[model samples]
Target: MSAIIDFTTAGQNFQAYRAEPTGVVRGAVLVIHEIWGLTGHIKDVADRFAAAGYLAVAPDLMGLAGLDATLLAELGADRNDPVKGAAAQPRIREATAPLRSPESAARIRDGVKEVFNHLEATAEGAGRTAVVGYCFGGTYSFALAVDEPRLAGAVPFYGHANFTAKELAGINCPILAFYGEDDTALTDGLPALIVSMQAAGVDFKYTVFSGAGHAFFNDGNTQTYRAEPARIAWTETLEFLEKHVQ
Candidate 1:
């Protein structure tokens, strides 16, 4: 079962959706949402992870203080409409702006720390733990792994890399990073980043899917959905988690 819970972190109350496995959990995973925040898609991802025999929890890292329902509604509504989707950019930016700031990132780190604390208190949290995210969430996943050493693994699907080689050195766990070959910004720096990670002795697996663009894993986005690559990515992700967490 999954429920919404509120916890205090960095002087603010953050909301999170936690999904527990049917019986004893093999491990715990912190699911992070995209730039749009903790929408239905993110919740669905959490539910999927729960079904996979893990205690999956997705925290509303956007502070959960002033979420505009109208904006959120538009975000979910425009998934299939490119014309309407363009209009949603500004709102999404506005929603995620707080997280872009260094101060806000620190707060989010604190929030994630609280989440880990709660998970550690659970029966299923004994073995291993991981963090996974999509798009913006992917970026946070990397940040969380760097900030929190307890994480057993980190997976970021098409997320922007915010940490440098120096910062990534702090990540003790393995990372499975997926990106799109067509993602301009990521494509440019990905090679060097991979090299740097290898040089720094960071255990990592990186894959770039051809003919797919950003947000390719999101089945909700008709324009960006590439069924084959998405499926492959999902399969690889599950396999990686099973090896590390279970």
Candidate 2:
């Protein structure tokens, strides 16, 4: 079974959609959503992880303290409507207005830290935690590895590489990153990232699937969805998590 739960961080309450493994647990995976906040597809991803024998939690990373609730709904309604999507982008920006501060960034990181804490408190496989995300969330998963030593592995789909050599040295876990050959915003940065990770002696492996574009894993958006790559990515992600999440 799956449900929404409240978690407090830095005196602010954030929501997460959590799902438990139908069988016993193999481990826990923190699933981060794209810039769209905690959408249905993100929840479905969490469910998929649960179905795969992991305790999955997808947090509402963009659900800031002062967001206008009505705007959130409108932005979500634009998910499939081209015209509405263009019109709703500003609302999406508005929804993230409060999170643009340094203090808010700390709060967001603290919120993620709490997920690891929750797993520890419950005696779940906190020590073997992995992080997976798409798009904006994927970017964060990369950032987390730069400073977080608790991560066992990270699977970031088309996320930008955002670490320096010094920052990469802080990573003690392996990373399995996925990218589309056509995602310039992400792949363009890979050469420098590869150098930094290699210099830091981090175990980093990545694959760029041909003929795929950004957000290829998101089946909800037909325009960018590529089933073949998504399938391969998923299989490799599971294998990587299994190999590392001991």
Candidate 3:
């Protein structure tokens, strides 16, 4: 079953696309969307997790970043078309620029916490929830692991590890992160991040796919999608979640 559900946190009401497992639920997953917001691609990913026997929820976390539902919807629609998506990049960047602000990051972090709290309280109970995210969502996946010790696991794809050793020390779960070797913006910092994670005693493992670029897991974009890498990453992500969350 699937539906749009409403949940509130810190006096803020948020809407999420939720998909329930068809059979017995083994675990639960929070699917964080790319910068495109809660587009159809995100919903489809949630459905895929549901078909895999995990309850999945993709929260629309754009409100705190200055993106309204109407604008996000239009942007999502534009992103579905190659030509339109290419042309809309500037607009998309402008609209989401506020997310880079420290204030917005703090607010979004709370939103993510609330979403996870809702999942634990109403869906999978406790100790059986993991997070999987792409791009922007991937960045938050790492942050959430640090902020929410109750998180079972985190799978971040191509997002920079922005936390320092002190912040990373707060993480209690294992992480399975993926990246494309060509994404220098992230891979260039991998060595330092590894050192920090090791010093923090965090169980962090990562894969950098050769020949793949940033957003390689986003098959919706022909320019960046890498089939073989994405396929392998998906398989590994499921395995990681099974071991940690299930």
Candidate 4:
């Protein structure tokens, strides 16, 4: 039902977890991962999308963070340990520092576009396509739209915005962003971002789950997962996708 496949972007090889839908494909989606590369959680997200009747692919964008393939895999695997996962947080952040740099962002942008190409060329894609991501992936989902206006929609869950106003203005697709009220580190800047998105006349809508915090939808991370909010978020996401991409 799902498998890992390799694709090249920026002259570097990377692997992605791809899932095909059970019935007629309504659309294709590019699922981006959190800070932890192409971890199991992200693969699960792709599979969930597939279950909803869409071809989904989650790319290992950690490659743009300068992590070697082997080490990236090890780090992704280590995220399963309750202790090691906690201890690995700092290093994970360090490794992802490169993602904020222009060069890395450009590479990641090019890489995701190539993934879209692969999906359309081989995955029996629909005319409409969307991008959805969590945390780190969510940030990129927003950023991707800044440059890739071909997307049908963009959904970013609990990700901080880092794109410029000029870039945001370039996005033509509607954005349905999610956040948790308690995620200070991520939500603190939301007010300013809302102003910018409005000023740019971008079609952006955001919802902040009252009791949920960062990574609330991440069922694998018990410390952060909130079932009720996650379920609500999932339902909302599905409705959004159906309206925009299906």
Candidate 5:
């Protein structure tokens, strides 16, 4: 079962979804949402993790503003069609801008802390904890890894790549990153980033799924969905978490 909780961060109340196994949990997972916010897909992902015997929590980063699952899905849909994709960029920017703000950053930090608080407060959640994110959530997952030293692992899928060698050096856990070979914009700087992480002694694993462009894991996007690659990525993610968090 799942429920929502109000967490105070940066003086704002951020809503977060929590899911756990029927009985005791093996560990805890913080499931970050996509650019569209905490939609059904994100919730479903959390449920999947819960079913796998982990306590899963998905925080609504865009909760300050109101957005429904359908709208989030539409916003997250393929933007390859210049007309549709280009138009969606501004909307995405608007939706995501708050997260980058100073106030929003503090809120996100506190919000994530609240998740850990919830986990540490529970018997199942106290064992170990990890994080996994998609798209914007993927980027945030990296940030969470840097900010929270207690995390066991992080898996970021097709998210933004923005980390300096110095910042990467501070990460205390392993990271498994998934990217799309065809995503030129996001993948362009990945090689350098990986090199820097390696130089900084950060244990990082990266995979670029061939022929899969951005947002391949998003089942709502029929046009860009690569079922095989997504399935493989999911399998790898589960394995990575089990290996590290367990």
Candidate 6:
């Protein structure tokens, strides 16, 4: 089952695409979108999680930045088209500019928490909700793992976050991160992050795929998709969620 539902958080109303499992649900998943917002690709990912016996919710966080579903969808289309995508860069940047402030990050986190609160209300979702995110969403995955002690686990794909050891120590759940060796902007910082995570005694595991770059799992963007790595990451992600979220 799938639907678009309205939710309120931080005094703002937002919509989320929800997918429910037909069989017994083993866990719940919060699917976070890339910078493109809650596009069809994200909806498809949520549906995939639902088919795998997990209730999945993908929130439109971009709405807080003044980007609606219609505009996000159009921007997403432009992002996937090489010719138009290049021309649409400025507009995309302008649209996302408002979300760069610390206040915006806090509001976004509140929205995520509200979604998690709803999931927690479910019988099978109480202590079994995991967060899976890509790109921009990945960064929030880390943030949530640190801020929300109720989270079961976190999966971040090619997302980077700078955290002091003190902040990292607040994470109570395990983290499973995926990265591409060629995604230097993020991968280059992995060693330092690893050190901080270890110093903080957090359970952090990661995988780096050779020949893959940023957004490797986003098959919607043909330019950066890596079939083999994405396949492996999907399998590993499912296994990790099954182990941690149950």
List RMSD in Å for every model shown: 2.1, 2.1, 1.9, 2.3, 2.8, 1.3
lDDT by residue (20-42, candidate 2, tens digit) is 98767888899988766787888
Q: Candidate 1, 159: how far from true, in Å?
A: 1.5
TM-score of each: 0.91, 0.90, 0.93, 0.90, 0.88, 0.96
> How many residue pairs collide in each prediction?
0, 0, 0, 0, 1, 0
How far off is residue 165 in model 5, in Å?
2.4
- How many pairs of residues collide in model 6? 0
lDDT of 2: 0.81
Worst 10 residues of 3 by lDDT: 64-73
lDDT of candidate 3 over 188-238, digit per residue (tens): 999999999999999999999999989898877777889999999989988
**Could you say which candidate leads in TM-score?**
6
Candidate with best lDDT: 6
Reference-based TM-score, model 2: 0.90
* Pairwise TM-score winner, candidates 1 and 5: 1
- Greater-lDDT candidate between 4 and 5: 4
List the candidate numbers ranked by lDDT, top first.
6, 3, 4, 2, 1, 5
Each model's lDDT comes to 0.81, 0.81, 0.88, 0.84, 0.80, 0.90
lDDT of 4 by residue, 124-197 (tens): 55457889999888988887788777788989998777778788889899999999999998789999999999
In candidate 5, which residue pairs clash?
Answer: 79-85
**Model 1 agreement with the true structure over 1-246: per-residue lDDT tens digits:** 999988887567878998888975779998988766778888988998899888999998765434554566577567457677787777667765665567766676677778877876776775487889998788878887788777889999887766777788888889999988898788788888788888778898988999998989988777888899899988898899899987
Clashing pairs in 1: none
Instruction: Give the CA lDDT, 0 to 100, for residue 1 in model 1.
Output: 92
Could you give candidate 6's per-residue lDDT for residues 1-246 as a string of tens digits?
899999998679998999999978989999999988887789999999999899999999987766565766688788778789897888877777877888888889899889988998997689999999999999999988988999999999988778777889999999999999999999999999999999999999999999999999998889899999999999999999889998
The stretch of ten residues in a row with the least summed lDDT in candidate 6 is 64-73
